[model samples]
Target: MSARTLLVDVHTHLYLPRYASLLRSRASVPMIRSRADGDRLIILDNEPSGGRPVGSQYWDRDQKLAFMDKHGIDISIVSTANPWLDFLSVSEATSMANSLNQDLEEYCSSGPSFSPTLQRLYGMGLLPLVPSISVPTILDEVDHVAQLPHLRGVIMGTRGIGKGLDDDALEPVWSKISDKGLVIFLHPHYGVSSSDVWGEKDNGHVLPLALGFPFETTVATTRMILAGVFDRHPSLKILLAHSGGALPILSSRLASCITHDPVVASRLQHDARWYLGKLYYDAVAYGAEELGFVSSTIGRAGKYGTPTTEAVAGSSHMTFGTDHPFFPPILDAVKQDSKWMSVVENLKAIDGVRDWSEAEKSAVRGQNALKLFGLN
Candidate 1:
């Protein structure tokens, strides 16, 4: 394992008080229901009774800082949690998005310092993305996020505007974001929505969350790639969640499918596999082998447009993340010093990769994030 220089988590989340209150007031699947133990968050339709426990960790800034300190994470780039404005009407979502962006600016800019030049926190803002929202309105929100000093990016779900990310409506928004140089933290929420595939089991959320989320991300990203979103706005900076789901492992398969299709192969400027190198991924895959494999896929992507078939180490495109508060210690930590299993697993994965040197491990741990976000 390499000695730690700095640790940055790009995949952390927070539901600010304003947003939490909105969820608390809702009567739908995305709402929060109060329980005897605490507030329970029911974001997913199939998330089972009692949902998941919601407490200070989801909202309180102090708790966020405590988690960072406990995990030795020096800097965190937080985004709004899932089901973000997805369930609201256009007017309501527009108002809430504005207030939330301002709140995020305040939350991040007012946080304590990790160093003289850097604050411990930065954030990704939101957009009013309901189906009824016009492209002009979406562009307005993008402009709003770009002007916020503390927000370095915008976090979004697979459903872009009304349709999926490949929809033509999102092209202007993509171009504006690309021109502004803001990173897009693309996350998953609707997760394939096919209950029959999992059968009628009482097996908790394991199937939907573990398998469904990643697959949804893969499908969404593939659609965007096929639509040539990357080729249109080549400068768009995007960070994919959950190691780009299964996209890394399936890139070659997708390339083969694309090539075998006479119509599809004629559209793209570069091979489909080349796009893997253009995106960033989170180190939340939970195992050393998966992380290492994802790194190889990303590293090897550079060879697609070049003559050389040699691979390169791609730790620079992967950033460490805990997905904290979502996956707490399964067994309650007896001592305050005990780390969450999720965080530990990700860190160990970075260390346990067979051929990664100290420098590569350190980059995945934090340095890559610093450069990607232009953080000091």
Candidate 2:
């Protein structure tokens, strides 16, 4: 094993006071409101509970530090949680995004008043992503955010420029983002189409959280590949959440599908497998077996001197993460525990993979993220 540290949580979130206040003021899907009980703060959603409780951890910097310390997270690249700027009007989205980005920059650089430990925090900036916004406006925000000292990248949902990531209208946005060397942290906001995955009933957010989120990432990225985005911008760095949401398992299948399609083949300069190699993945798979499979399959090497059949056949493309704040413990579980079950599970999975040296482990935990996002 190489001499390196064991853990870094690249995929965490902090609502940040400014963004939290914005959510509280609104009355829509992304808003926050106190329940009739008056004591409980809940995020507004399209479900029966409205949303989960909004606590200090979601908005307070002190709580964030404490959570990180308890969980053994040496570093965290925080970002706004889901439903980011998607519901706002064009003008409102742009302004709020700028304000939120500025606030995040400040909080990450200087510790929040309540907690000195927050000085260790790093973050990815938010962007205005409403459908009514113009492409140039979106590009401007991306360029501006890319320049912030503490801003390592931009957190974007699967919905690209309105018509999903495959839409040609978004090419310039992708081009500008790629050219700026800003890592695009692709997350999932919209779940699978209801008709295809669920009935008209509530399942306590399980379907969306477990299945819908990862599934959304898979489809959006596949569309981006099919559209030749990677072929056009080979340097574009994308970090897919949830270990690429079955992409490792399904990549070969996707490649086969693309290869068999005459129309897709004729338009692209390279194959789908080639594009996958250019992408990066977060180590968020739930099990060691899954993590090892994803790591080996996505970028494994071939016999002799030939390029591996898998697109991304190297360890550098994988990084560590913990989807925090969103997957808090259930009501009956221990609330004050230092480590979250969700976080520990991911760490254990990565550690349990056989034949990985300490250096490779350290790289996956934080070094890979540091290199990819330009974090020191």
Candidate 3:
């Protein structure tokens, strides 16, 4: 990796101090508990053990910069980790959303200077999308996020206004986001329940995190497309985590199914696959082959359109990411100053992808994100 080639991590997370404090004060499943060794974070309801260890890497700015320096990441667009504002009541969520957004602004804007030429940090703000929250309130939060200098977008879960993303109630929210020119980082929290697959064995979170999470994203986005979200808000910018979570592989099948169903066959303005080109994907698939395949799928979406012929390069629509603080190097895998396997694999995947020129690879590494987030 050349120093001249910028690397931007769009999928990084930070459990800001305020958020961690809020979690510690909670008494329920998503709370944080302090133990002998360290604090433990339990965000998922079905976490196998108690939860993963919480550390300064989650909230410490210097630690984040050090990790970035170790991995050669030039900039990162941090987002609040999963289960954001999910458990809070409407009033609490709204208030905290405001506070967290400000905290995020401070976290990004107050960072130490890394390079004279580089602005190292930016963020994706949160919204109060909990149930019973009025659209006006959410819209106001959107405006607030837009006004924040260091906030480039907003992170959201599969659920939109209590229902799934396809809910009609989210129409106003989507409109406001699009109108504000804010990218929606669509992430997943509550993955699909699969007792049938996992059975009773201590399979842990392997199934839920890997398969269930992406499957949830696939379902939620598919519903949004089927409900004519893209048709309604053509300018909406969404960045999908985990390379759209099996969406590229399953798009053709979904299109076929949509065509076969009379009720939905004539609803969409274009083929189901066309929307892939309009969206952005993070290169966190962990394999060059998987990244290449999804890139080709997204690249081909333009040609699949019914009446539009906008050809898109798949690589141009993808961005680099490291899901830091979530997947750190194991003790056995650690070498002195060694990069995490997770980050290395993703970087290697982008570098090893077939048919991508140096310029295209640079775009995937950081140029795309720079443009997507309007970063300097």
Which residue pairs show collisions in model 2? 1-358, 2-359, 277-311, 277-312, 299-312, 299-313
Pairs with steric clashes in candidate 3: none
User: Of the candidates numbered 1 and 3, which has the greater TM-score value?
Assistant: 3
Model 1, 1-376: lDDT tens digits are 1225899999999999999999899898899999888889998776776699998899899999999988889999999999999789999999999999999999999999887778889999999988978899989989999999889999999998768999988999999999988999999998977768888878788888999899999999999999999989988899999999999999999999999999898888778999998899999998999998999888888788657644545888899998877888756457656779889889998899986898899888988988888784
Worst 10 residues of 1 by lDDT: 305-314
Local distance difference test, each candidate: 0.89, 0.76, 0.90
* Number of the top-ranking candidate, with lDDT as the measure: 3
Cα error of candidate 3 at position 323, Å = 0.4
Q: Give one digit per residue, the lDDT tens place, for model 2 in 15-50.
A: 877777877886665677767754234433465565
TM-score of 3: 0.96
Of 1 and 2, the candidate ahead on TM-score is 1
Superposed on all Cα atoms, the candidates' RMSDs to the truth, in angstroms, are: 2.1, 3.6, 1.7
Ranking of predictions according to lDDT: 3, 1, 2
**In angstroms, how far off is 33's CA in candidate 3?**
1.1
